[model samples]
Target: MTDIDAPEADVKRAGDEGLDARLVVDRGPFRLDVSLTAAPGDVVALLGPNGAGKTTALRALAGLVPLTDGHLRLDGASLERTAPESRPVGVVFQDYLLFPHLSALDNVAFGPRCQGASRAEARERAAAWLDRMGLADHAHAKPRRLSGGQAQRVALARALATRPRLLLLDEPLAALDARTRLEVRAQLRRHLAEFEAVAVLVTHDPLDAMVLADRLVVVEHGRVVQEGAPSDIARHPRTDYIAQLVGLNLYRGQADGHTVRLDAGPSITTTEDLSGPVFVAFPPAAVTLFRDRPTGASARNLWRCEVEGLETHGDQIRAVLTGELPLAADLTTVAAAELDLHPGAAVWATVKATQTHAYPA
Candidate 1:
């Protein structure tokens, strides 16, 4: 399990710097090839669908999984052949993975003990970490006696107790209940902010990625499809998967000046000036629905669509439409009822050119 392609010749790499890695892992039919970098004090999130190799990439950095190719440099040294336990790395897994038989403090102290600290010294360090995580009172409690949030905090405390230069968290909040997740997520955010180290978190939850990381790297089928500041990625998703995750209607097309002709046989005018292959996107709420096509509508981008389905989403009704262009539209229940929207009902969908954003593909 500790096998590596080749060990770096020198051990001069500093632990306090940052992380720069290009990980490539091949597992029969699957292959993960992604490059990631994070500065000290920066938290980067790896987000994608299931089986997207997010956890594999994290493991490769931790040395639990071997890299088929590529290199991993932390701060300024190479960890291409470092063992998992020897690497200056810590991991908080999705399940928290606290020893059921051990007390919270003992669990947190275990890492320091493994690193050669005296029993008393390890306990002292563990106490400080638990106190920092607001779990000083639960230090004596076993993992079974702790609540979900408490156990999560203990796991984080254990990981941070190791004083790793590069910390890895895989679905850090996935084990908690909805209510506990909210509380733990906030607490975890604070802890991550205080850590002056390179932190990489893997999560499928968009909210978690948005709230926890300074930047997001989106993986798809073992490849990095997008990487950017959270806000930029949210506003301008380059792929359909990203657009769907961000709740937008996206269409690929060819752009000429302010007009783009969709590959689906519809043309949309956008305010952006772009050419060649492009993507035109807009919010579901930007779409206006009408029972019938209106003459001389101010919105020039129009499509005659048939309502494929309808469902209540929060305070709005989300309608799936299929026709000249396939897309989802969000309308208030009142408006939907007024238009008698239902499956098979014909409707006109319109969006203002100003509301649509077009970018090069």
Candidate 2:
């Protein structure tokens, strides 16, 4: 469907010299409102859990979904009333949506044909793209005969062949096997870097977002929770979802000097001293577990906790603790065996103040 019907006089403009959009879509009980802006050559990743409205935002930009409010613009021209096929947008969907009936060259040629290129011109352009993608020899292969990586590259070529002003990638790497994913991810990163247009990517994998995107926009429950450079967000997460994604234990609290009293009635000691509401965060490895209280522990923050569960985390074991405070501790197999960790096992958890980071909430 096209965007919400509006008069030409009422149409809004954005994306001056690149892309800028404030997408809002309302569907029954769900509403998606997201603001996006990017310059040419920028690669932005949209990250979220299921039903977080990430796909809806992407569709709105593509004109696949109608916008209830807000505007869409590319190169400073209005697209709020543009049809999906008419918009200067290209999409590489999660499934790579290639036509099984078409050969690889024909598939990539389809876009230019639709845009009014002659048969010979389209084929020549498609051949150049296929060659650039390292698929020149596979031009005659059908979609079914192509490997997952090959299909993905063909899909990307088809999208890029259109010479769209804005490109959208939905879970570009989710369809590949681990090995193929590794290879394609590197190739995709190189292609994206060379793309001079604005590109928006959607994925649930933290590594993909970190590796493929220049900036990250995190969505949750139809709203943006946080957004910034991948490294900045990884080191200083503002929400629990971001904290978990970056492998850290985070808590909200009110800070008084070095002590931050958690909203849940516990206190965390941090290295930074500041007043008012703040966030305290640290890595799971910062926690140490002991079967009995040691006479002289170096850690000043101690809590009586019970092991709620245990799980393998890479080369270490992650223990979930509850009772005096909720915490996660990472310990080696030998340490876990010495503590005899299990559900309901009581232990004392200690965290050195130096390991905790404090920042304004």
Candidate 3:
């Protein structure tokens, strides 16, 4: 289930005919270096922060950006130097990039037409694809007349009609409204799951990645920071970027008995008994903040912190604090007023030992 770099012979012997590439692209001060390998029927999602080279990696795979080094292989063939149009790759851009002048039907048929299909055959194939996307009624409608979701499906049908061996999507749902995104996302998931070839999507939304991808490849600063099943990554994040993405306060420390002495400065008591290096994680909701230290509190894990900032997170107010420990705590709107939580308010933070989960790093 892993797609990290493996020996070439081992991969070939397993009958893996999918995407095998080590892309290295340099642009001025930024350089993208990412290695990817996935077999057929695999939907891999690339997740990262802005300027993390997620788009650059996708462009390199599509041949839009030439690689400075490394190889690009798909189904036992090397496409390292192949032109974008010559490669067996299909790209669904962030904006859907549909043709303004052509109707939905003609736009879809354009891919097959470029691949040398006859006009009649292309239209026949396009019609069937639109029907499959549940957009048969809108086949003759121009891009201006169709909705955002309709345009996205048309773009997908067009990309899939060419029979691509490797499909790449750059921010597939970023352009849609919230409600439309949810609907289109479910449709896209079904299509990608049905796709028999390798499909890779780049997205910033954690929900989109978790719901759509069979596996996630988390990139940070032009490198693969973590790659695994979405559940596995969510349970045990290896970096701060991922911890924030999955909504957890993560800290690495040395563990002995039930105590974890954080490398950053403080110690956290947890229910798990472990030894050596370990990661201690707890949710923001587990933290309780007060104006002063409580004398009869049941929580053994306590820290003195100052409120650095505050923001509304969902239905609660999430306050950022820094002092004895830097962490985020979620409190009710009324409780925040009671504590007088402001930019410089001093507060005592406490968490029950059972709320913390410790695992070997």
TM-score of every model versus the real structure: 0.94, 0.94, 0.94
What TM-score does prediction 3 earn? Answer: 0.94
Question: Residue 95 in model 3: shift from native, Å?
Answer: 0.8
lDDT per residue (tens digit) for residues 189-297 in model 2: 9889877778999998999999999999999999999999999899889888889898999999999999999999589888898999998889999999999986698
lDDT of 2 at 215: 98
- For 15-56, candidate 3 gives per-residue lDDT tens digits of 549999999999998888999999998999999999999999
Pairs that clash in candidate 3: none
RMSD, every candidate, angstroms: 5.6, 6.1, 5.0
Model 2, residue 181: C-alpha shift (Å): 1.1
Worst 10 residues of 1 by lDDT: 1-10
The C-alpha lDDT values of all candidates are: 0.90, 0.90, 0.91
Superposed model 2: Cα runs more than 4 Å off: 1-16
Residue ranges of candidate 3 with Cα displaced over 4 Å:
1-16
Least accurate stretch of 10 residues (summed lDDT) in model 2? 1-10
Error of 1 at 7 (Å): 34
